[model samples]
Target: IVLDRSGSMAFAHDEVAKNGSPAAAPPGWKMGHAVPKDARWLDTVAAVNGFLDIMDDSSHDERVSLSTYSDKSKADVKLTSDYTEIRAAMNTHSRKFKGGATNIGSGILAGGKTLGDKELARSWASRVLIVMSDGIHNTGTEPVPAAQQVANEQIMIFTVTFSDEANIQEMEKVAVSGGGQHFHAKDSQQLAEAFRKIAKSLPTLITF
Candidate 1:
């Protein structure tokens, strides 16, 4: 799972509840973003943990690596089935730098490297890369071309725009280039449902 940890993500997703918002809201708020300045990273992390839950409920059994980017990209967890590791990484990362320009290209490149041939050699194992962001790529390399390269390798890329600040057009390009779909979620409900759909879309193991 590729996550965006830039400072802009600290902005409040205070929009009203919608039709398909995440079934579970964060502890405090009934519906909306639950992030304080010092606790600014909770909004995205809450949705992500929910996404992780959906994955756990699914039939697929595979380790998921997390790649986060702001001004630069970093791999938090190598490949691990332990959901706790991903959560720990998020909790630890929340305390890190929360300000920087969004460098989406860096995130994509890191994800590709982390999940390249060595990490994903099973031909039968369908590969998918999910890129979520709340803003446009304003730093580092261009993400479109990088996404194209990953697509060339047959890795499906699903792009998500979680806020109105995100560049829908560019994210759409990335999804199309990577041979996948683009999703937009202005509020928590839509965000939760987006993850649920992605989980459902993953390649499932068939039994004879």
Candidate 2:
């Protein structure tokens, strides 16, 4: 999974903040409510955690990798069945989500590299890359070309445009280039449902 942790992800779903806008500190003593100030980011984390749970309950033999991008990209975990490791990396990265540019291409490339690593990957397993972004790509390599490069290597890319301002057109093209599907989620519930649907559809790919 390639998740966007860019600066703009710190805003509400309807509020499209600039690329470098300062992130509000996570809710604490200063805020009466326990929920974090960044509603969109909170929803994203919840949806991802929910995705993990659904995947765990499934019968498919799946290995998952995590890559998060801001101004840069980092592959937090290599492809593995150990979902706990992915969660740990995700939580650690969440704390550092202060603010940065969105580099969707970097995130996609990072995820593809991990899945493409023959040494770490199972030869018989299906390869899929899920790229979820909440803002426009403001930096790094062009995403569609990156998707093509990965798809050429047999890695299918699924994209999730997580807000009203997310680049739906560009993401749709990326999904097409990668030979997968594009899903748009305007709210948290839909976001979780999208992940659920993606997870459920994966095991059937080889049969088709």
Candidate 3:
């Protein structure tokens, strides 16, 4: 999974009822009198955790890696079946994921490199790289060319655009070049559902 840790991710999502508060709105107020907006990072984390849970329930053996990009890219996890490790990296306050330019292409390249390294050792596994971004690519390598290069190696790349501010058209082109699909998420619920769909679609491609 490639995640965007750009500064814009610190922006807020639609308001939701706070913990311990009733889910249903009172009478006139939406979400029970305008609670604080959930940060995009928080919602992304929750959606990712939900995705991990669904993947864990699958019968096929699957391994996942994590890559985050801002002004640069770093592979946080490398092809592990231990989902908790991925969860912890997002949940913990150890690494503050804030402030940086959105380098979407760098993230994709990092993910492709990680998958390529593992492919040499595990040729039997079907590799898929899922890249999620909440902002436009302003620095680093060009995403479409990078994605095409990876696709030429027979690795599928899925692109996901989160929030209205995301560049859906550009990401859709990336997905097409990479021989995969693109998903757009307008809100938190849709984000979770998008992950669900991606996870559920993998079993067919997975080889034992």
Candidate 4:
């Protein structure tokens, strides 16, 4: 999965209820509450973890990798078949960083390279790329061209737009160009459900 670590993700959304709180309110609130800044990052992590938890273990042949992007991009973890190692790497590598630009193009390219590096050992029937972002393509090489490059390499590019601030039309075009799905998630619940949808669709692709 490719996560956008851009600064705009700090924007708040509505909160959900738990514990003895009223079904509509979060804590000391009315019918609704916005997500606190302190809680957004953890909510993202939990959403990712929830998706990982539901993935079917039967597909042992497949390998998964992760990448995050902001002002620049880097590979958090390379493609690996070992779930334990991936989980550990995710815990260690997925840090909260506040950067100005969103280098989503570079992020996708990095993910493609990571997957390509493992292509010799693991032949994937379908290569999947999941990108989650909350803002427009303000910096880096234009996203569409980069996305096209990845598409030419036969990688499916799934995208999740987390905020209205993002150019959803362009993101959706990227997904269509790469033969992947596009999701719009404005809050924690929508984000979690989006991840679940991605997990459920994983089986449709045959991993070599």
Judge candidate 4 at residue 96 and give its lDDT. 29
Runs with alpha carbons beyond 4 Å of true place in candidate 2: 19-35, 206-208
- Candidates 1 and 3: which is better by lDDT? 3
TM-score of every prediction relative to native = 0.82, 0.89, 0.84, 0.78
Compared with the true structure, what per-residue lDDT tens digits does model 4 show for residues 110-198? 87777677543366357888887777777887778888998888788888887556678988988887788899887788889998888
Clashing residue pairs for model 2: none
lDDT of 2 at 41: 71
lDDT, residue 30, model 1: 23
Which model, 2 or 4, shows the larger TM-score?
A: 2
Name model 4 segments beyond 4 Å from true. 14-39, 93-96, 119-121, 205-208
lDDT for model 1, on a 0 to 1 scale? 0.73
Candidate maximizing lDDT = 2
Off by over 4 Å in 1: 14-40, 117-123, 204-208
Q: What are the per-residue Cα lDDT tens digits for candidate 2 across 126-176?
A: 789999999899899889999999988888889999989899999999999
True-structure lDDT of candidate 4: 0.68
